[model samples]
Target: MPLLEAHGLIKSFGGLRATDTVDLAVEPGTVHALIGPNGAGKSTLVNLLSGRILPDAGRIVLQGQDISKAPAYRRVQMGIAYTFQITSVFPNMTIEANVELAAMARHKARDAMAQAVDHALETVGLSDRRQQLAGDLAYGHQRLLEIALGIVQKPSLLILDEPTQGLGDAEVQWFVDLLKSLRSETTLLLIEHNMDVVMAVADTITVLQFGRVLASGDPESIQSNAAVQSAYLGG
Candidate 1:
C-alpha cells in the first residue's frame, strides 16, 4: 500500500469547489511534487491533508488506516507533519528554545529532548545561532527553522509548502539540496513553484489546475507533458 493516499477528495466553499475529486498517492522514500498556477488550490489541498481543513468528501489513508476525520494534533501524532509556506516560530524565543519545545512535544522528555533540539538545529545548519531569537534570524534561516520544526518529530511523511518561496538563487539551491538529502529518511510531499527545483529533485510530479489534477507522472514525463506546459509551464 502507498504510504499516503487521498481518494476522491473534495472541498467546497459555498458554491465553489476548491478541490474537485482529487486522488493522489505517495509512496515511501520518494519526493512527490505538487505544482500548479496561482489559485490552483495547492495550499488548500495541503491544508486538507494536514487536517487544518476537513475535506467535504474523501478518504485519507495513511499507512493503511483512515485518517479523514483526524484532528491536526492527532494527524501529527500519526506521523503527518506539515510546514507552512509562511514561517512559523516563536518570535520572542531563541531558536534553540523553539526547537527544544518541538522536541519536548514529540518525546515528552527533557534532557534527551534538548539533545534532539541540538540535533535538529545542527541538521538545519542553525546551531550557530541557537541563542539568537527566532525573529532575529535571516529570512532564509527562519524558513529553515520551519522545516526543522516539522522534522523534529521524526514523522514518516513531511509536507512542505513553498519552502523556498522568497529566497534568492543561492539560498534556493541550498534548500533544494537540503530537501534532496531528506529522501532517504522520510517521504516528502512538496508544493512548490520553481520548475528547476522540481525538475531536479521530484521523483513524481502532479500538476493541479483549477483545483483538479491535470497531469501526473515521473519527472521527465511531466517536464515534457504538453498539457502541463500549457497550463503551468506557459510555453
Candidate 2:
C-alpha cells in the first residue's frame, strides 16, 4: 500500500475552490515532488495533508489509518514532519533546544532524545552551532535548522515546502545532497519551485494547476508532458 494517500480531497475558500477532488499517493522510501505555479493551491493542499487545515471532503490515510481529521500536532506524532516555506525557528531558543523540542514531542527517552537531537543537528550540518541562538543564524542556516527540527521527529514522511527558497547556489547544492541522503532514510514530499532540485531528487513528480492534478509521472515523462510543459514549466 502507499505510505500516504489522499483520496478525493476538496478544500474551498469562499469564492475559490483551493483544491478540487485531488487524489495523491506517496510511496515509501522515495522523494515525491509537488510543483506548480504560485496560485495552484499547492500550499492549501499541503496544509490539508499536514492537518493544519481540514479538507472539506475526502480522507487521508497513512499506513492504513485515517488521519484526515487529525490535528497538526497529532499528525507530527503520527510520523508526519513538516518544514515550512518560511523558517519558523524559535529565536530565543538555542539551535539544539529547537531540535530537542521536536524530539520531545514524540516522547523519546531523555537519552534517546539527546541522540536524536544530536543526529539531526549533525545531519543538517548544524552541529557546530548547536549552542547558538536561533536568531543569530544566517538565513540559510536558519533554513537548515528548520530542516533539523523536522528530521528530529524521525517521521515516516517529511514534507518540505520551498526548502531552497532563499539560498546561494552553494547552499542549494548542499540542500540537494541533503535531500538525496534523506531519501534513503525516509520518504520525502517536497513542494519546491526549483526545477533543477525537483528534477534531481524526485522519484515521482506531480504537477498541479488550478487545484487539479495536471500531470504526474517519472521525471522524464513529466518533462515531456505537453500539458505540464505549457502550464507551469514555461513551454
Candidate 3:
C-alpha cells in the first residue's frame, strides 16, 4: 500500500469547490511532487492532507489508518510533518533550542531528544550554528532551520509547501541538494512551483487542475504530457 492516500476528497466554499473529489497516493521512499497553476487548490489539498482543514467528504489514509478527521497535532503525532511556505521558527530561540524542542515533543528521554536534535541540525547543515539565535541566521539558513525543526521529529511523511519560494538561484540549488540527501530517510510530498527542481528531484509527479488530478507519471512523462503543458507549464 502507498504510505499516504487521499480518496475522493472534496471541499467547497459556498458556491466554489476548492477540492473536487481529489484522489492522491504517495508511496514510501519517493519524492512525490504536486504541481499546478496558482489557485489550482494545491494549498487546499495540502491543508486537507495535513489536517489543518477537515475535508467535507472523503477519507485520508496514512499507513492504512484513516486520518481524515484527525486534528493537525494528531496528524503530526501520527508521523506526518509539514513545513509551511513561510518560514516558521522561534526567532528568539537558539537554533539548537528550537530543534531540541521539536525533538522533545516526540521523544521522552532527554538523551534521545538531544541526539535527535543534533542529527537534525547536522542533516540540514546547521550544526555549526546551533548556538546562534534563529533571527540572526541568514535567510537561507532560516529556511533550513524550519526544515530542521520538522525533521527533528523523524516523521515518516514530510510535506513541504513551496520550500524554495523566496530563495535565489544558488540558495535554491543548495536547498535542492539538501532535499536530495533526504530521499532515503522519509517519503516527501512536495508542493513546489520551481519546475527545474521538480524535474530534477521528483520521483513521480502529479498534476492538479481545477482541484482535480490531471495526470500523474514520472518526470519524463509529465514533461511530455501535452495537456499538462497547456494547463500549467504554458506550452
Question: Which is the leading candidate under lDDT?
Answer: 2
Off by over 4 Å in 3: none
lDDT tens string, model 1, 65-131? 9999999888887888899887779899999888877765566667767766777787789989999
User: What value does the lDDT take at residue 181 in candidate 3?
Assistant: 90
For model 3 the TM-score comes to 0.97
Evaluation by lDDT, superior candidate among 2 and 3: 2
Candidate 2 — number of clashing residue pairs?
0
User: Candidate 3: deviation at residue 44, Å?
Assistant: 1.2
Clashing pairs in 1: none
Error of 1 at 18 (Å): 0.8
After superposition, candidate 1 runs with Cα above 4 Å error: none
Q: lDDT order of candidates, best first?
A: 2, 3, 1
Candidate 1: Cα lDDT at 110: 71
lDDT of 2 by residue, 1-235 (tens): 9999999999999989899899999999999999999999898998999998999999999999999989999999999998888677999999988998878877558888888898899999999999999999999899999899899988999999999997999999999999999997799999999999999999999999999999888999999999998998888
Residue 20 of model 1, lDDT score:
95
Top candidate by TM-score: 2
Evaluated against the true structure, the overall lDDT of model 3 is 0.91
**Candidate 2's C-alpha lDDT?**
0.92
